[model samples]
Target: MTTSRSTYHHGELRQAVLAAALDVIAADGPGALSLRDLARRAGVSHAAPAHHFKDRTGLLTAIAAQGYDLLAAGLAGAPGLRERGVRYVRFAVEHPAHFQVMFQPDLLRADDPDLLAAKERASAELRTGVAGLTDVPDARTAGIAAWSLAHGFATLLLTRNVGGAIGDDDPEEYFRSLTGLLFSPQLDPHGGE
Candidate 1:
């Protein structure tokens, strides 16, 4: 007799499939995802993952949504913009698979409700990091700059594109120093040095 333990319920199967997919992404990349492969890894029917996620985009959407939530959580406790930037880099390094998919809008269902909510939550947290920066004329532009700096550094580190130019220095340390340089006592918007 087939016991319930041998058969995962809907929610269980979904979670299992998501985990397996993330493993595949971490090992390979998001482009390597295959529902059949994920199903095999999860020990579920080939159709199981498809049923839950609908398609590759669906699965990636779910992952992107989850990534935003994780990023938001990581940034939530950060006390300042620099700390939040550090947290962002850490999150990308720790969750490479999620980070890879989170920014690839073409690979996800951008209109998915969960993804929208998650993205907003992350954006809000990011804004909070720069909210007190009166040195920047526009909070939105400063927030974007902070996010861009962190994201660029993280992506470069992940791809090893720095080409050993930063040899002997930890990427996190390098990033912190760079942020410090950029965020150091700001110039007056009125052309004061």
Candidate 2:
């Protein structure tokens, strides 16, 4: 049987290390992450991760950048603001490790070029979704509100704070209903009571 210490080809090392890092984050949280541990998990020498990531912060920056790109992709082409919000929540639930690392700026290089670009891409996608809210008096504030609802709900779910309350309920469907309450005609600025 191949051992955990089995060597990977050069081209595979970076991705192998990243996958190991994600697994570590998922199982033990980011605080438990270490390049040496990831190297061991990826079956590489302890110094292998540094060849690709430079250091722990560099590794986290890569993860954060990747997370934002994934978030942007998930949000892209959504039909409307509500759908985009649902997609956002889905992304967080589906990629909990990435979601966990993506928001912790203290653990990342906030000025990393790839991270900044990916973040902007995700933001632009959300802005596009908000722009479709023609009935809202202020799209910017509306966008923030929509994002807050989705992010907060996802955070609650991830933390298990809402598990019992939402037991057996389809999270996406529940989120859709919540969005409906917020975006109902009664709340539309241009709609008459």
Candidate 3:
């Protein structure tokens, strides 16, 4: 009497495997993922994923790549760099598994070409988004500043630092307002003093 909960057909096992890996990572973080656990989640045999992923690192690399694609898309749709920062936080919250694996490079196959490509794509999009809103002359400085501000804001929001500053008055809105100061056009030469 096997009561199967999954309806995934055989042909879609690869995607099913990835969805299961993300499920595992979201629940337990990247370090806690195992092929056995992923298989269970995917409703496949324990050894099934080896044919697709080779190892746990391979699976994690795929998850991180997916994360980068998602992050690139999220930032691209933002109204401005400030809102892009907010969207960054939103993406992390919505894709906790991808965020966890992408940030913890040591946990995944950082050397994988696919993962590297995705990382570059996401990084470039983030930098391009910042450039679109700022007149920062040097590419490196703009990159550093944009990354630090967005990453720092995302880290703070993800860790619940918002409640301490805003006293629980809809923390997300408060966070958006604070980071808006970071990207204000008033910092420009003619926009403000």
Candidate 4:
């Protein structure tokens, strides 16, 4: 069994401890997480993290919240929906620890205020962009299509389904190029569906 190294007090200990939890999840599976492990990572005593997280579930919840916040931030200031899609995948790739927690609903409170707010912000941006770019008229439908495209690609990358790293001017470039034709703003140039 792992042990703790530090004992952070109240105050910012919650966020700091949560950050440490993410590092653990990133390194190992969620089962590897424990208050003592987080404490050790944070250089605190065994029980230090528990005061802040109460339990492993609490810690995971906080990590998911942070993940959503990071996701929302990445989506913002994007040059366009294309850039945002790339950024979203990049965020998941770069923060696999956070991404893992964010998607595992059984482990965290994805419905928390912070999580909900961040989710809404990300979804709203995607919806708005798709609405402006698609003839689908219905914002939800267009948004779903746009999200499904990039999200499927990202999921593939996450699961290592693509195999091997994407090269310079690689296949991903081919897909990015397709966004123009596949997700065009023009209203059914090929004729209505």
lDDT: which candidate is best?
2
Error of 4 at 169 (Å): 4.8
Per-residue accuracy of model 3 over 51-165 as CA lDDT, tens digit each: 7889988888888898998998887755555566667777877887788788887777868898889889888777655566545566577667766776776677666675577
Better of 2 and 4 by lDDT: 2
The candidate maximizing TM-score is 2
Collision count for each candidate, in order: 0, 0, 0, 9
Per-residue accuracy of model 1 over 37-137 as CA lDDT, tens digit each: 88777776778789989998999999999999999999896767777888899999899999999998999998999999999999899887777567667
lDDT of 3 at 143: 61
Show model 3 residue runs off by greater than 4 Å.
Answer: 1-6, 133-139, 170-172, 186-193
Q: In order, what lDDT does every prediction score?
A: 0.83, 0.84, 0.71, 0.68
Tell me model 2's lDDT, rounded to 2 decimals. 0.84
TM-scores vs. true structure, each candidate: 0.88, 0.91, 0.82, 0.77
What is candidate 2's lDDT per residue for 8-80, written digit by digit as tens? 7658888887788888898889999999878767767789789998999999999999999999999888877
Candidate number that wins on TM-score, 3 or 4: 3
Error of 2 at 62 (Å): 0.4
Model 2 ranges with Cα > 4 A deviation? 1-7, 185-193
Candidate 1: what lDDT? 0.83
Of 2 and 4, the candidate ahead on TM-score is 2
lDDT of 4 at 26: 72
User: Model 4 Cα displacement at 90 (Å)?
Assistant: 1.6
Sorted on lDDT, best first, the list reads 2, 1, 3, 4
User: Which residue pairs of candidate 1 clash?
Assistant: none
Considering lDDT, which of the candidate structures 1 and 4 is the better prediction for this target?
Answer: 1
